[model samples]
Target: MRGVDVLSTAFKNAFRSRLRTSLTVLAIFIGAFTLSLTNGLGTGINQYIDDTVASVGVDDVMTVTKASEEEPTDGPAEYDPNQIAADGAPGATATALTDDDIDTIAGIDGVESVEPSKSVMVDYVRHDDGTRYQLSVAEFVPGMRIELVSGEQVDLDASDPELVLPESYVEPLDLGSAADAVGQTVVLAVTDATGEQVTTEATVVGVAEPGVLTMGGAVPNDVLAAELYDLQTTGAPEAETTRYAEASVSFDTSGGATQTEALQDRLADAGFTGSTLEDQLGTITAVIDGIVLVLNGFAVIALVAAGIGIVNTLFMAVQERTREVGLMKAMGLSSGRVFSLFSIEAVVIGLVGSALGVLGAVGAGQLVNGVSGDLLADLPGLTLIAFDPVGVATVVLGVMAIAFLAGTLPALRAARQDPISSLRYE
Candidate 1:
């Protein structure tokens, strides 16, 4: 048969045995569906992470801390007065980052600038005659951003103290809605270094929507954070007050991951640990990727099982068409043409099944994404399942390739038939 005739005959022949072909197609469909869905899951989650990275403005920022000098051992070492315990970790000690450390980080190659981070604690927050509620303030870095439901991010250069309230606090603080919370004034109570309570008033510049980076707390402008830090250290020694737990370092990453890694390595050699936002969130992405890989493994197994079905179905078709094959060979068709016919038929089956599976997966993914979008409204900008065109195409092509490979043995058997012997036997 010629090209068009071969293809037309192959397609017509593929479904001659309706029940058997349908079973084979169904098998391929299951594998294709599973593979597409898992790929979409990975794509969706990673896309969300990328969006968060862009939205939060932490793409080129790295958090740096003084490396601990204490060696690891089975037993705890003697306490050192100079080492300070991190907040929330009662007994864990960390080397403090001092002015010299900040200066050292600033002097490193590729470093744009450095800002020391300050830990500020607030006893309670009260608005007007509302009852006091405990609160925590997050340090505001220069390039960091907060997703706001109302108003704008805190104005770092503004002379007066300013802060952004978490959306959760609006109702309990009697601040009405997120919109109403903006421009309101609130009192923050804190204890000074002298062991005395100090209260400060700060304007609410914005109300932030909940986000992974925000850590479910109020965000403060540099001015407000400095004010709080100063108040907390009122009676403390100047040297002690300058020590910090960590610092934010801005770096040039135009050369990409390699350059970033080199900078981190340099920082490590300088007795500091530097981690980019991606580095901090790597564990989460790694876990997600691993889960996707595992799910894909199941899909691959299904595809392999489907390949066996293709093999069996084609083998039966070859047997049933033996007389037809003998007649075609007598009518001037070559063994290669017979092989091509069977292989093309297998491909046709694969195309039908994979196409159906891809379409079904896309439809199902959209439904799931819609339901999840509504259910996870708080986590804005997230799509639980998103399909990539390339990935979908890859799945379809992959299934078809498996089908072609599985039909090889059947095609070979049909090609090897002796025209005279096959015609004489039934």
Candidate 2:
């Protein structure tokens, strides 16, 4: 028979048992829709995590102080006065990282760039309004994650004290407009390495967009440090100045697993032991992927139930058509034709159901995203609900394949019917 004639025959047969055909198609649609939703949600979540990590410059690694090997010293007897506080006991000491450490790490094979930064907690006040905030701040190391949104970045060697503020902090202080805040003076109260509250003034040189703060709240670090030095010291002049205890190192290329291992070895050789951001993210992604795999597996149970429905429906169709199969054979239709007709009908049901399933999944995804927008508005990362064409295609094809397989046995049974016996018995 021609393709058009076969299709027409298939449609006539389906229409003769409209309720059964409808139920079979509905089963396929539900299965395909559920599969699409699960796959799309998983893809969206992974994309969100990747974007969040990228925003933070996940390629960089930070080196901080390790636990001390030496035991605590007693009495001030052998202690260096510079290392001891006025109380004569060991004072609050900072990490020993210095330019020498930077030089050592920079020499590592994979290292592309390194920036040293230090942070201290302090009290800050607006010069004009005198409003105070307990601020933790760090200095700008040029060519780092923090980018200047207004004005210029602080000059590394400039004598004048300049500062940057987190964009979020700008509105609360009424720092005028972005332009107005530039060149304005703000006062910072901070403790030096020796631990004394010192206050000094600095120009608001720039502002950073939100999500860029690495260590603490979004106060400008350079301004805080310079201001602390300007404040008059109440104690002896010989007090040690606080230094940055760590450095952020960025590589030229994405090292993936191999690069991470090489970088860790280099860091260990330089006498620093700390976790890489990439390694931590890898661990997190692995855990999340495992959880998703398990959840997807459970969801597949629904699809299996729908598959079983398809099998049962086809089996019933075969039983109903036994005498029809005998008539077709006596009318000169071959066994192959009889089988082809039923198989074609099954495929038609699957195709139509899969198309509807795609529509349903797309609509559901959009609804979910609309409702979730408000909850995710303040979040720094990508949203988790999304429509992915590849994932939709995969689900549709998978359901259709399952449907075709479910109909196979019934098609074979209908084809193998003995024409004379089927007509005589029924």
Looking at model 2, which ten-residue stretch has the lowest summed lDDT? 80-89
Tell me the lDDT of model 2 at 283.
64
Mind giving the per-residue lDDT tens digits that candidate 1 earns over 1-426?
Answer: 579999999999998999999999999999999999999999999889888987887778898988888787889687776687774457776788999889999999989999999998899999996899999887666778999989998896899999999899999999998898889999998899889999999999999998777877899888889889999999999888989988999988798999999999999999999988888778678889999999999998999998999889999998999989999999989999999999988888888888998898999999999999899887888988898899999999999999999888899999999988878757
**lDDT of candidate 2 over 1-426, digit per residue (tens):** 677888889767755778988887788777777766776677777777666567656455544332233456785544333221211136654335556666776787777776655444556655576567655565444434554558766655667766677656666677877777778887767655456766777778787655423343444445345455445333535333333455667665465767677777767766665455555556667777777677667556766777777678777887888888888888888888878787766767777777787788778888877777766644444455565777777777777677678767788888898898767755
The true-versus-predicted C-alpha distance at residue 202 of model 2, in Å, is 5.6
| Model 1 quality (TM-score) | 0.88
Clashing pairs in 2: 138-221
Show model 1 residue runs off by greater than 4 Å: 67-95, 121-123, 190-198, 231-243, 253-262, 281-283, 424-426
Highest lDDT against the true fold, candidate: 1
TM-score for candidate 2, please give it: 0.67
CA lDDT of each candidate? Answer: 0.89, 0.65
